[model samples]
Every structure is written in C-alpha cells, then in structure tokens.
Target: MKSIIKKIFLLLPLVLAWTACNDYPIDEDGLLITTRSECYVSSFELLGTDQRSVIVDVATVDTVAQEIHAEVNFGTDLHALWPQFTLVTDAKLEPKVTGFVDFSDLDNPRQWTVVSGNRKVRKTYTVYLTVQEP
Candidate 1:
C-alpha cells in the first residue's frame, strides 16, 4: 500500500503536466485563438457633449464600401463628439477610439482601420457626419 501511494504521488506531476499541454492557442484576453479573417465595423454611434446620442436615425454602416454615415440634429456640436464602434469578434481598431473627436469638418471624413484577430485582414473605414437642416 505504501509503495502504491508513493507511485501515485510520483505520477501525479506527470499527469498534471500532460494535462497542462494544450494544442489550442489562447489570445491575450484569454479567448481561444481563431483564424477568422473577418474585420469590419458592425455598428457606429456618436455622442453629443451631453453624452446623448446625436444621431437622427440608425447610423448606416456599409461594409463593402467601408463607410459610415450619421446625421446629427441641426446645431449639434460636432467639434467635440465621442464615437463608439462595434466590431466583429476578435477584431481590433487602430488609433483606438477612446475620447472625443472633432467631426466639424464635413469634407474630410475620419478614417479608422480595422484589423482582424488573426492579423490576416485589414479594412480602412471612412466616417461621415452631416447636420440636419433646422
């Protein structure tokens, strides 16, 4: 019985080590790594200075064209507005959108790039905002 107990203890580390070895990869976020190449903005939102939505209706996201269009109420301040974007799973955005950004210039749209989780695909998106007529 003592010999059996010693053998069990001796093999326990090996068993644990074997179980620790994994064939699958994990990302920094602890998510299982995948080879998905999909990269696009699924949704877009703009917030006013008061932290309220400035969009007149749902923002339009054109994946094929890689463009986003949003209409804000007339007189809405675009000089300091916050943008929020929802992207495909495991995708990342460049120049990560964090705080307020200037969208007052209608001619020059803002551009952001989306990179796939596997780093296999990249898409640059242009964001356009227009003010509704009072």
Candidate 2:
C-alpha cells in the first residue's frame, strides 16, 4: 500500500508535465507561429484634420501593382492628414502607421511595406492621393 502511493506520486508529475507540453510553435516575439504568407493591402483611408475621412470615394487598391489611390474632397487639407491601412491576415506594416503623417507632396507618393506573418515575405506599396476638382 505504501509502495503504491509512492508510485502514484512519482507518476503524477510526469503526467502533468506531459500534459503541459504543447505542439504549437512560438516565434522570438512570443507570438504564435503561422504559415500564412499572403501579404497585401486590402483597403486604405485618409483622415482629415477633423479626424473624419477625407476620401471622396472608396480608395482604389491595386494588389498586382502594389499601389493605392485615393481622392479627397476639394479644399481638404492634405498636409497633416492621417493614413490608415487594412492588410491581409497575420500581416504587419512597416514605418508603423501611427499619428498624422504628411501627404502634402503629391508628386512624391508615400510608401509602406507589408510583412507576412511568417516574416518570409514583404511587399512595398505606393500611395497616391488627388484632390477632387471644385
């Protein structure tokens, strides 16, 4: 009876440890590993000074060309507008789209790079904006 209790105690920890083990992989950042590699910009939006969308129509996203085009209402201030992007699942953007960014220069379009979840693929996209004619 004593030996049986001793054997149970010895096997309890092994069973617990085995159950704790997981097959799921994790990256260096401690994020769950994924195999998805599809990376692209699905949508884009530009915000006005009042924090409202300045886009005149649905922004055009050219996945094949890796470019984005948006038209803003006439007289909309583009100097300090904010840009937002929607990307594929498990993908991330570089130059981290944060607070207001300057899109005042139309000739030199803004560029953003998207990285896949597996960190194996990258796509750089150019964004162009035009003001609607009054």
Candidate 3:
C-alpha cells in the first residue's frame, strides 16, 4: 500500500503536464483583417465653408484590438463632394468623432464637388469605413 501511494503521487504531475498541452497550436504573431458595418450614422452637416462633418459611431467587437484605427470610404455623391474625410475615434463624444469633407464653394468648387447649391443641409447616412491593423 505504501509503494502504491508513492507511485500515484509521482504519476499525478506527469499526467497533468501531458493533459495540459492538448493538440492546440499557439498563434501569437498573426495579422487579422476584420470588417464591420455595425457603426451607426448619427449626423451629417455642412461646415462653414468647404468642410462637412460626418458623425458616425465606431464599431465595437469583442475580438477587436484595443487601439484601432480606421479609414473612411464615402459614397459616390458624398465622395465626389469631398474626396478626403477626417476620422476620429473618441469614446466620450457621440458618434465617436466627426469626419471632415471639403465642400466649401459651388461655382468655384473644386473638381470634385457635390451639387448642394446655396442650401445648408444636414443629411444622415451610414458610411462604409475600413478598420485594419496598422
């Protein structure tokens, strides 16, 4: 009985070590690309002169990285008006942050400008943005 008890204790650690490393491979330096369309479009307004504010919520996912960066993809009309839009990600502010697109002038408007005429308008639309590991 004493010999049996001593052998059992010796085998316990070996059994645990073998079981701990099942058939799982470790992957730490893997680059993952994820897409999300769940971001909410809250507001869009024309800025003073040649800029527009597009407010949109940042996507939240359980597997997303802690410090995420995004790139904006505007639609044909909106994109034409302002080809470049600024992106900001802040938790405290609604819609996270405002994207700035330039649409300051009409007659003298740059080559790519949406026709809004003289009316100050605010339109809301879900923008397709790209978030990737950078």
Candidate 4:
C-alpha cells in the first residue's frame, strides 16, 4: 500500500503538467494558428484642439449588441482643426485610414473592415462617436 501511494505521488506532477498544456497548433512557418482574436477596436485617444491628448472616456465594446460607443471632447472651443483621434484594434484592419480623422459631421457613423491574422475571418465594426459638450 505504501509503494502504491508513493507511485501516485510521483505521477501527480506529470498529470498536472499535462492538464495545463494548451494544444495550439503551429503552422509550417512557425505561426500560432489559434491565437488570433476577433477584430475590434480596443481603445481610442484624441489630441484635442487645445493640444491636449485625452482618451475617449467611454470607448466600450458591446459584442452581444454588435456596437461600439465612443465619446469625444467637443466643447465649443474645439471648433478649428479637427482633433486627431488614434484607434488601436485587436487585429490588423485593411484599407486603413492614413490621415487624421476630420470630425466635421457629428452624426454619421464610420465603418472599417477587420481581417484576422490567418486571413480566414473578416468582421465589420461601426464606430459611433458622440461629442460630450458641456
């Protein structure tokens, strides 16, 4: 009985290590195939007209509702050049916007095409930004 107990104790580490290993497959090019995540903008920040950088206070992603909410500082003071906003996403997006965003119209929503790392999945996200004027 003591020998059996010792064997069980010796095998416990092997069992635990096996259970903790993830079975992600790597391609011939040594790229992880299953580590890619869904495409979505994770965060957004803007350099306001006053030359102050401020992060969008409410950039939230609602996957269940398939929508994104963003807020920008749009006081009456910021009426000259449009504040340049930067967006970072989970995955690379195609047809990327090269220049700064011109926030002239405050109503229309913008769209982007998000492509997965494997190029097998594509998703669209509609970004709606609201101006918080006070």
Top-TM-score candidate index? 2
Predict model 4's lDDT versus the native: 0.56
Instruction: Write one digit per residue (lDDT tens) for candidate 3, span 1-134.
Output: 99999999999999888775543322232212122223322222222224543323443222122122223323313332323322222101122234544432322322211111111222233333342223
Cα lDDT for residue 72, candidate 3:
30
Per-residue lDDT for 63-92 in model 4, tens only? 445456667665633233333223233355
Report residue 134 deviation for candidate 4 (angstroms): 1.8
Candidate 2 local lDDT, 30-103, one digit each (tens)? 66556889999999989877889999989999999999999999998778888989999988888787789888
Which stretches of model 3 miss by more than 4 angstroms? 23-25, 28-134
- Model 2 CA lDDT for position 112: 96
lDDT of each: 0.89, 0.88, 0.31, 0.56
Error of 1 at 81 (Å): 0.8
Q: What is the TM-score of each candidate against the true structure?
A: 0.77, 0.79, 0.25, 0.52
Please give the ranking of all candidate structures by lDDT, highest first, separated by commas.
1, 2, 4, 3
Residue 13, candidate 2: C-alpha displacement in angstroms: 9.0
RMSD of 4: 8.9
